[model samples]
Structures are given as structure tokens and as C-alpha cells.
Target: GEAAFAHKGGMHVNAVQKVVRSYEHIDPASIGNVRRVLMSDLAGRSNIVMKAQELGFKITSETPELKEILARIKQLEHEGYEFEAAEASLALVIRKILRHREPPFKIEGYHVSIRRDRAMTVCQASVKVKVDGVVEHTIAEGDGPVNALDQALRSALVKFYPQLKTVRLADYKVRILNSGAGTEARTRVLIESTDGKDDWGTVGVHDNIIEASLQALADSLEYRLMKK
Candidate 1:
């Protein structure tokens, strides 16, 4: 038999390991709370709804609006959006759907161009966004295509939503889901943003890197605006 010993006051003591028979002695409410805490760590639309309700938001898994949100989540996941890594963005989607809130802006179109010259490589982005039926077009240059696109989009949006100026991208990640497809492989992009007070993550998936990045970036901005 294996035994453990503890020394106290120059005396050796043997410690015995005991096993409990069952959880029957535990309070049912306490067990339920433990279960809930475990389930919340796993990401899913139902979990999102549960968390929303816990925060005093009136929503349910079976609600039509929740169903719509789930459908959208499924569609995006199928396209390569990984909500598990971007729960903050998913929460925002749930809030917007439950409240029937309109998006602050709509993207009309965007263009990203890369040029390589003898001097240096340049990336430029131009975006068209519609706010309150008025469309604003803006252009900007960045160290890379994604940076340029982000700058251009934010420039177009800051006029209507000044809060966006305080928001900045803190990190960005990209994962190729199907490398076997070569250049046509689907890609997932995760973007983390912070407003100096709070932080959040957003995700997107697409065959084109720019498209995926744009989707994530848009979600991050929308989430911040909604929270504000």
C-alpha cells in the first residue's frame, strides 16, 4: 500500500486518501451552477443565448430572432467563420438580432490595389459606405493591403460614428482551412480590437484574404458601435 506522511512538531503523521461515494450529498442548485459554468466555456448559439439571458437580456434559444442568429452563425461557420474564437463578436450579433437594431453603416463597395515599383511596394484601399442614405467614399494607403483597407473603412465611418476613432486593431490572425486547395483554399481571419477601455474579437472566412479580413473588421467596428 502507498502512504503519504506529514511532519508536524518533529512528529511524522500518515495521511490517508478518502473517496466519496456519490454526488448525492451535494446540493442540486450548486451542481446546476457548476454545470452551467462548464457549458458556458463551450461556444455555441445556445450558450450565447443563455449568457444573454443571464445578463438580463430577454432571449431564448427557440426565439425566432435567435433562430435567425443561429442560422447566420451556421452559414458563416460553413464559410470558415470560427465563432468559438470570437465569442465577443457572436455576442454582439445576438444582441443586435434580439433588439432588432439596424447596422450603423452599409458597405456599398470596396477596392484594394497593390503596386510594386522599383522604389517600394504600395497598398491602397478605397471604400464606399452608406450612412443614413448618404454614401461616403474614402481612400487611404497602408503598409499592406489589410492595413490600407482598415484605414479606408475607418476613415469613411468615423465621420458618422466618432467613437470609431478611439477603436484600433490590436491583433490579426489568418488560418487556411483547406491548404490542399492551393490558392483557392478557404481562409479564416480573426481580428481583435480595443477601444482603450474594452476589447473584442471578430471573425471572417472566405477564399479571398481581403474579403475575410474585411468581414472581420466590419464586425469589430459594428460591435463597438453597438456597445457604445
Candidate 2:
């Protein structure tokens, strides 16, 4: 959903258009796609084939070479393994099953806030960081709870690894699993992040929506650290 603007200094709008056109003539105004690129090896290939087919390309999923891969994918998906959650990760699982990487960072704590007028829909953020046995904390505000929480986490990580500096919150969605009458509700958040190298998705759920955001934010970096 829509969140606050932290660093909108780049041509993200143009980049989005390029990707949209790369796929097909999609009307962004109608779709509300803030970012246009899809980032994943598996999604890349699948998207290409799907786009071609959707744009009237004649092809069959039953190609002798694709049958097994397709079936396996469907099997895993039916079993609850969602590649759509992390495309690079799905492909990596096959190759990296032999060896896993080490984690680079650990989170300890964080805080976020939102005020009037600035009462961001995504109003929360906090980060606890550890590097080389040393610890630090960084917090930032966002348009929503999850966005702010992730921004805080990434801000901390980027200080240690410059590569993380470019990562951006691509999309966020929240679903209420239990009604709160008004003030309290158990919510689930799905967060999507992009940094050009890869894209990933993480989920968080908790009674306090802000805490739920923290849970997902923690998983996001944990996943990234594992890759590193």
C-alpha cells in the first residue's frame, strides 16, 4: 500500500515506465504500479514467457524441457512453498542446497513514530544493529508501520554494508486476521524489497500491527544476511 516518502530523489518513475513498457503497454495510472520492474531469475524467465504469451505469443507449457520443472514448481507451490515470495531465493534453493552462507547482521531493538498531519498510515520504525560484536541503533519514520520499521532496519544495515544503501521498500500489504473493534487488531504484513541485485518478500504477523511490522522487518534482513 501507499507509504511515506523517504528518499524519492531518483528517476524511479521513469524506471517504472521502462519496465512496464518492457513487458507490455500497461496503463500505470489504472494499475497504480509504483515500481515497474520484476526482480528474480525465475520470475524473469517466467515473466518473459508469460508476457509473450499474454501479448499473443503462441507457446505451450508442455514443451518437453519444461514439463518437469513446471510440475515440480506446482507441487512445491501446492505444498505451501511460494516462489512468488522470493524468486531469487527459489532458484537459489536448488543451487545453494549444497552450502549456505553466513549471517552478517543481527537486530536487537528499534522504535518508530507518527504525529498529526504527519500521521503516516505507515507510522513506525526502529532498528537495533550489531556488527563485529559492536551494536548501534537507527530509527526512521515512514508512511506506515511496516515501512517505517523496515526503513529503520535498512538504515542501520547500510551503515555497515554500503550495498544495502540502495535497498527500497517496493510494496507493502496488510491484512487483518482478527477484527479489533477499532483500536487493536491482529494484522499480517507482506513486505517486498528491491536493491537491483535481487528482490525478496517477508511476512510478519502480530496483535500490534507495529510489532508485526518489526517481525517481518527482522526476517527481511535475516534473509538477506543469510544470502551474504
Candidate 3:
């Protein structure tokens, strides 16, 4: 069903945009599906224009922000950030350019520690986040470092944005960008989040796995908050 109307390659997508029958055999709406043009490093400006329109923003070839958004996408892709499957991150980029809105919260500092005994292991995290100039310090314990960090971060922010209680991490994926670097290789994290009513994907890339995860995690909650 997905293969029926999902277009990715730049040329194919451009053609489909010009004429749907150029590549599609049936109208997507016939099956209650809509044509999707996936965004990636291979995307053209038309892809950005269409995607922004779908997100409730009008971005034409003449729009100054269109060029900046395209350049930003290309630059991020070069840094090991993939947007084809991370529309939530891509939407944030568009919003940053179009609206110039400030983020709801800022992370001031965070620390994670692991304790091991002969019988078991425990991971604890402490997070300091600033919301509207007031700092919230939170601590949490989880099964692993990432889990602990997630808990601590959310606990710190939830008080300011109560709507975040409904948001949860649905899935997580990690990819090493430079395998040859082995232990020092950069990592890219992709996070899927859902707030019961909607699901979205966000991505982050960094040399440190924990930092990468935090980047993706922060985007997930920020995206949810932006919706409100």
C-alpha cells in the first residue's frame, strides 16, 4: 500500500508534482491515501515547497526562506542528519525559519551516573532546565543511562508544559556515521514519539551517543509542545 503513492527520488517527485499520472497508475484518494513526497538530501526545491505547504506554510520559489531552508537541509544532511524519515525535525526547521519562535525551554546542565553492585546495576540522572528564566532541577533513576536521562529531562519540563505527559518515546534507532572510527565514530539517533493522537519522528547527530539521544529527545518534546 505504501509503495502505491510514496515518491522519493527528486526527478520522480518533480514529475509527479507536474503531473500525477506521470508516475502513478491510480489516484491515491481512490484508496483513501494521499501522495507523499519524502524529503531527503536528494530532494529538490519543489519538494520543500510542497512539504511546507502540507505543514500549513506557503513557501514558493520566490519566498526567501525557501532557499535558506533548502540550504539548511543540505548542510544538516552533510552532518549525518537524515530528514527523510524525520519529518518532525524538518518541520522544526521550517518553523524556525518562518516564525523565528524561541524554544520553550533550554537545558542548562545534566549529569548521569551509573552504580554497579555484585548483584545489580542502577543508573541515575540529574537535569537542570530553564523555562521562561526559571530553572527546574529534576532527578530520576532508570534501567539505563538513556532511560534515566529521558526521565530526568521530562520530569524537569513536565511542570512547565503539562501537555507533555501524553508524549512517549514510541521507537528509537541508532546508526554510526563513521564506522571506521570505531569507538570514536559519530552516532545518529532517530526517535519516534506519540502523544496518543499523533506520531512524529525527530533526529539528532553527535559524536557522543548520549548527547545525540538528548538532541533527538529534546526535539520530540519540543515538537509536541509546538503543536499546543
Candidate 4:
């Protein structure tokens, strides 16, 4: 029902941002929904302004940072990041632009090792992170390198942010940006996470699948922490 009010194209989003009734026929709130302005390569300054406002930032087309944010969004989209389906990551980008959000923890380093045999394969990940000036290191094994990395990072962080214990990945998807590049193609990882109450999606892009997955996983957890 609310999907009817979802605006995507650069021009449409800009118009809707300026005057909601211009594109939307009815008041979205009347139906217990909101007009969503999706961010994409086609997004304009209006889309960025609407997004910032949705994230609780007072911004406008006149804001100087709006140009920088739009440029950064386009650059990242060119690099294979898709923000339309990853509003959580987009919100984080705005938070980064405002320099108002501080990470709950900082990853010091991480290492993932995989072993393959005729019988089976094993993946182990070791992660080190710092929270409030204290360091925590943990090792965990999982079904895959990405899973192992997520487990290891969560294990290291759960000590300080117990809320993370409830967060789990609901879905994971990876897309090769340039199939012609074959194995050398850049990858975009999209992760859907939930804490049994709310769900959010985050995106990452990199030439290394693992690195891209890590970026999305970090954004997923960071987005959850931002709620608190």
C-alpha cells in the first residue's frame, strides 16, 4: 500500500521532496505510511535533503554540505554501492557527513583463515576491537568466511554492547558489478539484519568479496547501535 508512494527517479524525488502532494495523490499519513524518497545514482539534492530530514537532520537544498553529500553518493554509486535498498547505510553516510555519530567500537584488525579437505571445509576468523579504550579479541568458527567474521566480531563486541547479542543476519546477497571482469570484478554485498523487532539493510562495495561483506556487516551492526 505504502509502496505506491515510493519515489525513485531523480526528478520525481526532487518534486516530491519539494511538495509532497505534487506526486502523491493523498496524504500518506492518512494511511499510516510515509512518502519514501529513494536514493540512487539518479538522486538529486532534493533527495539528499529529504533523506537528511528523515534522519533527523535539519538540512535544505541551500546547505553547502548537500552538494558534497550528493557528490559522495554519486561517487559511491559509481563504485557499485546501491543505497536505494540500504537506507540504513545511507543514514550512516549522512551521519558521517554531519560528523555527529561516533562508532561504539573500532575494529583494530581481523584475520580469516579457511581450510579445505576432501571431507569438508572449515573457516575460522579472529577479530580484535577496541571499545571505551579497552581491547577485546575473539576467535570464532562459522559455515563460511563471512559468517566466521561476523561471529568473531560480534563475540568481541557483545561484551560491551550486550544488545548486539540479539542482532542476527536475516539475509545476505552479493552482486558482481562487472561480470565481464570475471573473478576480478568488484562485488556489492547487501546484508539484511534484524533484532526480532526491526530489520534494516546495509550495503558495501569492494573488489574483495570478504571486504565488501565485512563493510556491510559492520554497517548493519553499527546501524543497530545507533538506535540506542
RMSD of 1: 11.2
Better of 1 and 3 by TM-score: 3
Cα error of candidate 4 at position 142, Å: 0.5
Candidate 2 structure quality by residue, lDDT tens digits, 140-227? 8876666677777888888777766767777777777657555676677677877678778876666677776666666666666555
Q: Indicate the TM-score of model 2.
A: 0.50
User: Model 2 segments beyond 4 Å from truth?
Assistant: 1-103, 117-124, 180-184
What are the lDDT scores of the predictions, listed in order?
0.74, 0.55, 0.90, 0.89
Regarding TM-score, does 2 or 3 come out ahead?
A: 3
lDDT of 4 at 140: 100
lDDT of 1: 0.74
Q: What TM-score should be assigned to candidate 3?
A: 0.95
Summarize candidate 4's per-residue lDDT along 1-228 as a digit string, tens digits: 758888878789877757878998888888899888888888887788877898777887788777788888999998889987798999888878777557888889889999997888999999999999999999999999999999999999899999999999999999999999999999999999999999999999999999899899999988999889
Predicted structure 3: lDDT? 0.90
Task: Please give the TM-score that candidate 4 achieves against the real structure.
Answer: 0.91
Candidate 4 regions off by >4 Å? 1-3, 29-33
**Location of the lowest summed lDDT over 10 successive residues in candidate 1:** 8-17
User: Which residue pairs in model 1 clash with each other?
Assistant: none
Q: What does candidate 3's lDDT look like per residue over 87-177, in tens digits?
A: 9999999999888899889999999899997788999999999999999999999989989999999999999999999888889899999
> How well does candidate 4 score on lDDT at residue 142?
98
Candidate 3 clash pair list = none
